[model samples]
Target: MTLPTTAAAPPSAPPRTFSAVLVANRGEIACRVIRTLKEMGIRSVAVYSDADKDAKHVALADTAVAIGGTAPAESYLKIDAIIDACRRSGAEAVHPGYGFLSENVEFAKALDAAGITFIGPGIGAIEVMGDKIRSKNHVMAYDVPCVPGIAKPGLTDQDLIEAASDVGFPLLIKPSAGGGGKGMHVVEQAEDLASTLLTARRVAASAFGDDTLFLERLIRAPRHIEVQVLADNHGNVIHLGERECSLQRRHQKVIEEAPSALFESLADGAAHRERIGEAACNAARSVNYSGAGTVEFLVSDEHPDEFFFMEMNTRLQVEHPVTELVTGIDLVEWQVRIAAGEVLTVAQSDVVLQGHAVEARVYAEVPERNFMPSMGRIVALAEHGAADATVSGQQPDHANVRIDSAMRDTLQITGDYDPMLAKVIAWGEGRTAALDTLDAALGRYTLLGVDTNVEYLRLLINDSDVRAGHLDTGLIERKLPSMEFRHAGPRELIAAALTLWLERPGSAFAGDAWKVPDAWRVGARGAWTATFGLPGAGTATVSVTEKDGSVTAAVDGGGPVNVRVADRSGTGLVLEFDGGLVTYAVGSAPGAVREISVGNDGWSCRLEVLDRAERLRRMLSGIQREEGAADPEVRSPMPGTVVSVSVSDGDSVEEGQVLLAVEAMKMEHQLVASVAGTVHLTSKPGDLVKADQILATIHVHVATEETANTGQNTDKEVHP
Candidate 1:
């Protein structure tokens, strides 16, 4: 099989055809690839795990194939199954859309052996750039400056310590085989190096099937900037400029923007930008790289000209939409065209960036509690600012907003894979306009059922420092303390009360609720109190009394306020509470559970109605709950497999000691004891546990002098 060896090769004799392509991955990227395939008039073959039978990507494709189970190892990562699905579906090409098998060289080799075109770089490039250590070594010949550290793979802990000592403190221990912030750690002290390395190696081995580690000097406040390079088989390699990915949490990027603001701060910004692009093209040329790839760098925030090569992503990045918005190039389409022996149409000099663009990754996670991955069904979702917003009453800027997501209403966000639910991208003429469009877009975006970081992203977009272009890798972590979690306010409380009132079958407003103006009567102006439960917090008692065409209400023993019905329905209600109107989208299942979403702030809560008797019962049972709370049992925070157990059934443990580690959503969470006690283990390593399942019980009353080494009080305290 001959390949193109020149920069502008002549067209092939027959013009190779790709009638159908199999997306060997899932989630947003798969959908993204499928969309491009549709535009190119090619059939799309989607493969899914058992968990994704009803996924949006599967439904969007022309045909679908069931691979295997929910775990990626049994499904998307299985080369044999993917190839079989391709053979059955008549797919001529396989597009590994990032993650899973995207960077897996073995999968590429298998596809090559099966006579399938892999829509990425060839075997040599994959082998060279897929490994971080190897990529660093290869790029050195092209004058690509790399971070100063050891690149030796599979180094011993002692060797790593010595290397760290040479690299200085605050260095990073990263896996060589993969990216995506997995299996990466920062070592701040020499003493903590060994344990951190061990854990890093463990995560790398589990996540990527390789434990090979690499050491690099940490750039304390460097901005993460990566240049997107597109290469064709005809030796055409051009860069689409850089994407600023500094705002990160746990080393994973939360927000990314094209034409980095850091460059905007530079005096010779255009010259520096062209220099970086040339360097990226040089990096791509180093390995005869083909298809769409990213060359990441850690640019000094203080010195814009100083940058170091990080690593080459051999696949499309999660933040590619932002680049497409700015450059007007469909990278996915280019990947396919390049694989089919097409020459690059746009030259490096002709490529131009039109406007600023920003992309915020919407995730199923909690921002306040350390960004723990939240999983469950998304009951509702509403998005806006799509096609750009007309801001300041001016003619709409050519800027626009786009949402790339694999999520839909009632889609369960399983813990089997990544927690990113969607990507919301916005574009405008300038940074301020782009950010303002992003803010409006996020304000209109609402996701319910599982917890999301929508509100947190909104806060981040509105942040003054963020607006001022002050960004770093640690920006999210530094500002996290100031980002507060909001709850159901007065409007939500009033809506909840109104919903309950309308649901009562015995009330006069039950059947003909719309006709009766004040039919939610409690014996004609009689006052009644109903306790409504708040999600994640205690209940609020709403006392209401119907009067002439209106109602007087007091929430949680607060001062009485006038309330009037703006509108009423069986499934929803709009009420004016304290002269402010709010609407609630109400949903109820077969059970007594009700979901209420407030329109004012998009605050949605799942409430359980408590009658007077049930309220009294719960209050009385609080004593029993308090008793259980006094002697706390450590539980799994999410549904996952128990990776390791640090304590035995009769082991004496100190407070803050790690009881066990749980692996969920491609990350590890260590569960620690809150009190000093003797632990009784209920589950062992490799045991599967559901969310909130008790994993171990720590008894504070254990009669062991050794357990009281700290001399702290053993008296029961309320569990935090």
Candidate 2:
């Protein structure tokens, strides 16, 4: 079923609808806002950085202005440039869609000074509620219960350590600014408190521009629930129910839904919903807030009735679609209407919750590898569902299924912004139906050429605890160890090899098998061995032979299995492997000429078809390197800038000591020592390194069992 996103009705006097409006954002949210603007008959102006000239949002808007820079600070965050664009375009209002300047008080003030309407809460409200420390202190007077913590301005590493006991053990260190769990860390024990604070403060300063942090008691088995509140300039405030956001990893929400399943299990669920909704409204009223905002709360799974105020998000949340789908209210249209000075026509009694809706955030990440951010070109794109993706605009290529995305063919995914590509939201008559719809949609969400978390998301949503709504903040971490993620097996490997070999110019697909390159020949039985470089330092060798018009393939010299390719298109291929028909999404990117990507059943893998000479060289080199010897080299796992280096050159460290951190795509990965030895560093802070680039080498001593046991250790036995 489609989510009805009709524009709001015309409002009364003292204000007028603007003919044009500017959206100061990028990516899917920008595209989402422009859709609503079109429905309202308002001209939408899009501002883009240099990197986004070909982005979906820019093409969707009626007019586009290039603020012109790839980095956020150079373009989207430039307040003066955005104001100038608005003035030049004759736009009377601007929608600060979430991230960039949505909660920025100075940006709102600048708009007001320029005589432009800001489609959000007032500057005072943004200022008070933007900072987590201030918002927590401000809402307590209104009787909103807050978690016990040492929350105040200017708490340093020492301040937190000294007050650690007062706050209690197992406390959380959180940055007062920014959302999305960017600079948050949990200190489980007293011994790890100081070092975590140092890293937390550095990350906070780098991310939020303010290192101001506070501490909170880590709620055990806690569920994260947030209530959506909408307030107008005319003192009209209402709550749009609540969203269950407990399914998260590292405090980053992975899945969210409306009408908490935990609440539905309660005896008097309606009363509890009303109480929580009223509490959210009370928090909004205290700040004199206006426009769409979310009040987040932490509730324990054991005691579903008891709740505590966590922090109020002063702007629209990434999970707002679920609220819109369940309530049948277009929040963006209302935001524009409110900014145009409208009064609330629908009362609290008129606000009714409908069917359940669930949303899954699809990110460009490798979940199997600790959720590493993936960046590349969109080589192939296809989506399947009953309905077309909600659109009023020119996001030319996206499949059906209530998808809010800026994804398209050939669009480049870079590290300049967040790795979140799109959101897949589904609705049904009941919670079970909604969850089932969501899972099916995720399975149908196909994308290739870049690694994604889609497969892991399916595994997660189908988990026994998740399906049963045994939810908590730590549930994802707890379930991750037991979750089995699918990998590219024999079918995928053979498919990749055959597709690459068959697609050449003098190719096997051309009817003359002898004309094909590699090991093709016109003999009674044609046989060839192909080597492929798989993901994560893996390699697969497949031997193929053609006889009697049927192909049999053996992987790494295993038993032969039947394989057949029935179809091949620009985007995918239909193959019958081991007597089972499967449609595989296939693609290749310019950056990788020898590489090809293949996908099936919500999982995808990229493998390189190595030449015969290259494969032989690698095999010889691999043999030369001892298999069980301690590798002295520490390579960067990903391409990113070195944010922090913990150890100095020539410093002796233990095997597990933290050496440095690499930051890419808004996520940070800490690299640790591989073995106990003296580190010979090659990289330092602020160095931009590439994937598998050696950052350091640990000089270690290694000896054979015979030499070590005989106490004949010599300098020759030491290895570096």
Candidate 3:
């Protein structure tokens, strides 16, 4: 789809030249924006919170300014702090890179009042399109197709309920004020509409400060497709084609690509693209949109030709690199050029879709555990770029792959923000080639000392339906049951024990006398053993025997297998084991933390070497616990702030009852009681809890020996 190069221009004004620009964001996006500013010879200014003082973006900028505290509200979300930094650094323009305050109308207004340029759309556009309800209603007037239902600025619960019949069953209730799938509910019957609407409104008011609600017919097996449109102050707009974003979990996109494979599957694929692309341009034109924007749509997987308007993002997208790769256009550069009052030099016809591009978002999460966010210091970091690129914090635009990241060696990944670590984008002559490159790139991507979904992403891309382009919103959920997730195996256990054992003092003679009295025999070395606890997979004993500079190891008392370290480097291990040579990526916790991370062939795990006391505690627990009983203690899945506590101390609860909720990395996880019993609370609402910290405990009664004969139950106390 192409934009007509004819429209009324804005009032003629003096061209503005920007010598310095401030990136009002953090992480990979901040680094990405800075790269373009550097290439354009514009001095880049970066702002940081206390947590980000040593961040890669701060180091890459010519000058860095400290804004405020560590949390987003105290720093990144503070408009005044950012504006002050812009003034202090003499930054003439500010680029709000995607998240924080990118589409904030108030921020844009303040910048305009301060005579500073905003490298994005006009105030009117952001103000209107920022609201989901307003954008949906507003776009329809411009010949944009919309999901059928009721959309009004001030629709009350009664108003929506009255219109529910016409909107039909299986409708969706969405908060008009915010995105991210928050405050959205799907109602299958009219009877359930009222209560769901109430919940939606409350969430909307709390999350977005607006209680506005709207209803839309829930499209069955929907595919998320977004179009990248570029518009200037001169009313000229051109599209860069469409991207398929259906592969998601918890309503967050995991994989994205352009041009859409979903669209390409249609009988009239090119015509469908033209229609959707033109609609996207119309949506932008309706708001007089400027700079780079993405118009997202919901297309039915069952019917590929039809698309309904979703929402308009008035800033750069996280998946913008794929659009850039396929079209050979740098969106950031054009954003700057458009902000500087430059006219559109590239016409609609000139926009050619070249090759194919796919992007995978890298998140610090454990996919097997419901995508739980993981946090740790980056003991090791490697990406699809030269080793130096990680240190420089530059966007790596390789021949086939482009990496957008702010990761560096020793960086602390905290739960104070979103868990997205980076993005890996790959390009090729076709979708298959592009996907192959992406899978290979992800395999080489190494970020240790923390759990990540790298291995899960590999499995996802290789899925048969995914490879066949049979994508839908429900695909990931339906496929989750059959997905075989990897964990720490015998080989992993050997590596973990060997890593710690070799680094210990006097390893040649180190052995517990009582446990292995024969370890000191003259003919053979005594067996040295270390206990390691694997994440989710329980514990194991790895015994290593060394004689004459040769090493042999066994896990869980299995037969000894020959093993030797061929080479060792920073986070790199080359080992000859069981007649095979392999390169394994590894990381260890600093100091006496006793944790080690090992990975090879994209499957990785962080295992902890338990001390004597912890190992004994586990052994005692195994001996005392009842058969087939769930653990009494409920642990927080990740480090987060307690958001709610449903059960109070001494409250009787049923199995699987929600006890509390913890919010970490912008996601909320509910902790549940594992058994029917009296509940005891540990952490309350607003209390910060660490990962695996016990938040509550359910005390179930056990029958005593004498009571068992009479069928009487008694309580016994246990403490952490």
Which candidate's TM-score is highest? 2
* lDDT by residue (tens digit), candidate 3, 226-327: 999999888789888899999988778899999999877777888888888899998998989999999999998777777899999999988888888788
C-alpha root-mean-square deviation, candidate 3: 3.9
Q: lDDT of each structure?
A: 0.80, 0.84, 0.84
Candidate 2 residue lDDT tens string, 593-698: 3677889778887777777777887788578667875567899877789999999998989988999999988898998987887788999999989878999998
Rank by TM-score, highest first: 2, 3, 1
Candidate 1: global Cα-lDDT?
0.80
List of clashing residue pairs for candidate 1: none
Pairs of residues at least 3 apart in sequence or in different chains that clash in candidate 2 = none
- Residue pairs of candidate 3 with colliding backbone atoms: 519-526
Worst 10 residues of 2 by lDDT: 391-400
- TM for every model, in the order presented, reads 0.90, 0.94, 0.92
Give lDDT tens digits, candidate 1, residues 465-534: 7888888888888899977778777656766677667665545466644454443444564666667766
Off by over 4 Å in 1: 1-14, 385-399, 505-537, 543-549, 567-573, 583-631, 702-720
Clashes of each: 0, 0, 1
Better of 1 and 2 by lDDT: 2
